[model samples]
Target chain A: MTIKVAILGFGTVGEGVWETLHTHHEYIQKKLSTPIEITSILVKDSNKKRNLPDSVQVTTDIEEVFQQPVDVVLEAIVGKQPAYQYVTRAIEHGAHVITANKEMFAHYGPHLLELAKEHNVWIGYEATTAGGTPVIRTIDQMLQVNQIKSIQGIVNGTSNYILTQMTKHQNSFEDALLAAQQKGYAEADPSNDVDGYDAFYKAMILSQLAYQDQPNWDEVYLEGIRTISSQDIDKATIQGQKWKHVATIELRHGAPRASIQPMQLNEDHPLYNIDGVENALSIQTDLLGSITLSGPGAGKLPTASAMIEDLLYVFQKERQQEAQYV
Target chain B: MTIKVAILGFGTVGEGVWETLHTHHEYIQKKLSTPIEITSILVKDSNKKRNLPDSVQVTTDIEEVFQQPVDVVLEAIVGKQPAYQYVTRAIEHGAHVITANKEMFAHYGPHLLELAKEHNVWIGYEATTAGGTPVIRTIDQMLQVNQIKSIQGIVNGTSNYILTQMTKHQNSFEDALLAAQQKGYAEADPSNDVDGYDAFYKAMILSQLAYQDQPNWDEVYLEGIRTISSQDIDKATIQGQKWKHVATIELRHGAPRASIQPMQLNEDHPLYNIDGVENALSIQTDLLGSITLSGPGAGKLPTASAMIEDLLYVFQKERQQEAQYV
Candidate 1:
């Protein structure tokens, strides 16, 4: 079986997915038990000279890619409007959709899941929250048996990167932010990450899945790393602790109470040693106690790798279903 | 739809499963989108006084449970002979099998997986490896996209408990083992745990799923924590480290290289803070960087909770397959 995939945006993550498909094609094929082909690539400028396979139809127009038959729509597009429209349209056309749009998922996710269920297709946002980490998949499997009571996560990589630098170098947050930007871990704007919007959205997404309850978005509190001065870092260091930006949501009185803030973690805490751009989350469950999952928060290949996993999952699931009656 | 389940060996894990079914019955049903019932329970002594629901039939004759219609068999039996035979028979009888038997799974797992595939029924052994930590499920999902390059795990809870006590109280290994036995973390014959046989079996099982290649059991090197003395513990403590019995299997080239032994871990390692009977595992993947997961390694409720997840997975798969044709 050949799964036809259409890439909506050919940026860093899109290029990574494209490269992995070409580079590790044999290994992926052997594991998937099927062949997968990139049929179309959507880009900002089709005239830009880039090295790619001749078989894939590189086009500037999104409509051109949608015109072709697609089994899976690999949407690497950012933001809310077009990404949401693209995902819904692809699902409407009988194609499973894989996305890395955290903002779109956090806001309009429940409706999209309903649409996918209605269409008998899958909407995979595993890459949206924590990039390469299997935290989302782990939680999905965990929820089958254990009801998570609390979740504390260092979900924003850029904020974590900045904080880690500030603590390690004992420098100002501004300098740390600049270092993070130079390392490509942060963007020029950096507001979504440093202002806690990114982690807020991710926490919302996690709450939806873990609790199956939509929290009042306005009620969830958030604080960024901008307020953590060098003096504060020194105090935490003196107290044998490190400052970490955490996104947390816990069940209090059977309802979820959420917050995003900087925490002074002691040595015994699992998130204490999770420095640099490393992300870690601890889920306190009724039966399983405290389970911590940590990894690289985001990267080009890591995020793309998550999308690749979703693509394979769709095909494998269909195959199993098909094999059941045969 | 109501799914009928049978329980084999009403021991600690088996009783825990039964209790979870009764306690979290409503929540599980809602999540699974179907009601599940325990139809029969096979025990060593059927006449033993125990409080259970009137609906569940307790029996000593395993044949009686086989004769009755079963959709899934929950095998919590330990050891090799009868558990293996029961699982094979259940699969043959068109009932999906869920097992928490590590020894049996380590030896005959591949054969049983083939049997389940051939019979078009699911065989889930998630509880067989790391209890309720969801490592098996995570690895199962991870292999779809990420090729695990290496694994570092504190897999055995009893070994971890002994080591934790020895380091904390500066006690001898013998005294620690006695304390662990009193705490129910270790069996009276804790040779399987302290001798690293338990972790060895888990590593073999992990290699089977993660690599899809059978590692020769005899070729796999094993070292127990019994050799570690108080002086060794003091040495590790002076070096700002701790001793953890870890089951590690890494892909050296394209094949698996595995070993189970005590390792002195530094402070920054995620597994360092994993004390007591807690377990932590880190999977280094080709695309996804180092992802670490930690939780309760084993317990009555935790192990049984893993079996519950497997039970739900089996039902969910069946539902998806049934929906495909409709």
Candidate 2:
């Protein structure tokens, strides 16, 4: 059996998914008891040169993807517009959906999940938060028995890189951000990361998952590292503290109160040592105390790795359902 | 529907499981789509005082537990003898089994998993290794795509506690051991922890999981923290290093090479800040780079939390199977 997969975008993460699926084809097939074939890839330009196999179809039309009997659709597009539409269409057509689009998922994930449930399909958005960290799965498991009291983490890699550079090298915020952009860690227009919108989106995703309820975005406090100065870094270092752009959410009175800000963390804090493009989440639960997971927050391979894990999960669930009939 | 469970040991973890289940009865039921009833508890001394509800039948005879319509059996026994036998028997009786017996599982887990597979039942031993860390599940997910290159961690809390005290307070190994025992972190024997056998077992379990092959017990190197002196700690501190009793397994040439020994880690190492009784694991994968998980490694509630999560997994799988039939 072959599982037909459609790629909604031909960006870095999409290209990574293609390469990894081909590179580990044998092992993945052995594990899933079925081979995965990239049936179609939707891109903005069909004339763009891509090093892809001849058998795979690369098209500019989204309808070409749905024309085939796609078993899964992976959305790697950045924003909400067509990614949400493509995901809902895939679910309606009886295909499972996996996405790395954080902006799309952070706002419409709950609704998409409900639609998938109604259609007896699955929606996986593990890459929408901290890439390759498995924080979503960890929280899902903990919620089985424990109440998540709080979640605190450094979720934005670009801001973290900027903060680490400013603290360690005594560079100004502008200089650090310039270095980050040159190193491909930040975009040219970095307001989404430096102004805390990126971390805010991730914090909302975590809050929704932990509380099973959407947070009031207006109520969530937001502060960015754009205002941090070189003197502030020196002051924090003198006090044995490190500045980290942290995303935090606490369950208070059965409601999730969340914020994204630059906080001075002591040496003993779980996320204190998480430096430069590394993400760490410290989750406090009633039954298990504190559990911290740290890893690569964002990268081409790491984000694609998360999406592949979700794909593997969808296949495993399908195998289980098939075994039930036998 | 109701799931019937029997626990075979009335120790700390068993008591914790009972208390947590009762404390969060409504929440657990809401998640599982069924209520779990502890129908019986197998204990050596039935007359011993236990603060348990009368509805739970405490029994001295193991046969009495199998006589009931048990769907799941939780084994919290300490050693290999009865745990292995009882687990095998439970599988033969067509019951899913979840165990916290590291010694038993480290040696006989593969055989029991095969037996459970033949009987079409599930086996969960999440508490056998690092308690409440979910390293086992994390490795399972990674195995779907990435090759686990290495696993390094402080899997034993007692040795870590001793090392922390030795480094921070300049205590001798004997004094640190005494302090650990007083703090209820070390057992009376202390051989399993201080002698590195406990960490050795956990390392073997991780090796088996990552490589799907048992490491030869004779080939695996093992060392304890008993030989570390105050002078060594002081010298390492001078060199800006700290001692950690780490369990490590590397997949070299498609085979697992395992070891448990004290290593001087630099400040930049992931496990350097893991002090006191906190446990930490750093997994190096090909696709996701390095991921580290740290949390409470051993305690009554933490260990029981792992078992409860496994129980929830089993129920979720059962629900999926039922849904497939519907």
Highest DockQ against the true fold, candidate: 2
The CA lDDT of each predicted structure is: 0.88, 0.91
Lowest-sum lDDT 10-residue window in model 1 chain A: A211-220
Winning model by TM-score:
2
Provide chain B TM-scores across all predictions.
0.97, 0.98
What TM-score does candidate 2 reach?
0.98
Query: How accurate is chain B of model 1, given as a TM-score from 0 to 1?
Result: 0.97
Q: Write the per-residue lDDT of candidate 2 for residues A197-297, one digit (tens) a residue.
A: 88998998898899887579999889999889999999999999999999999988878899899999999899999999999999999998999999999
Per-candidate clash tally? 0, 0
| Residue pairs whose backbone atoms clash in candidate 2 | none
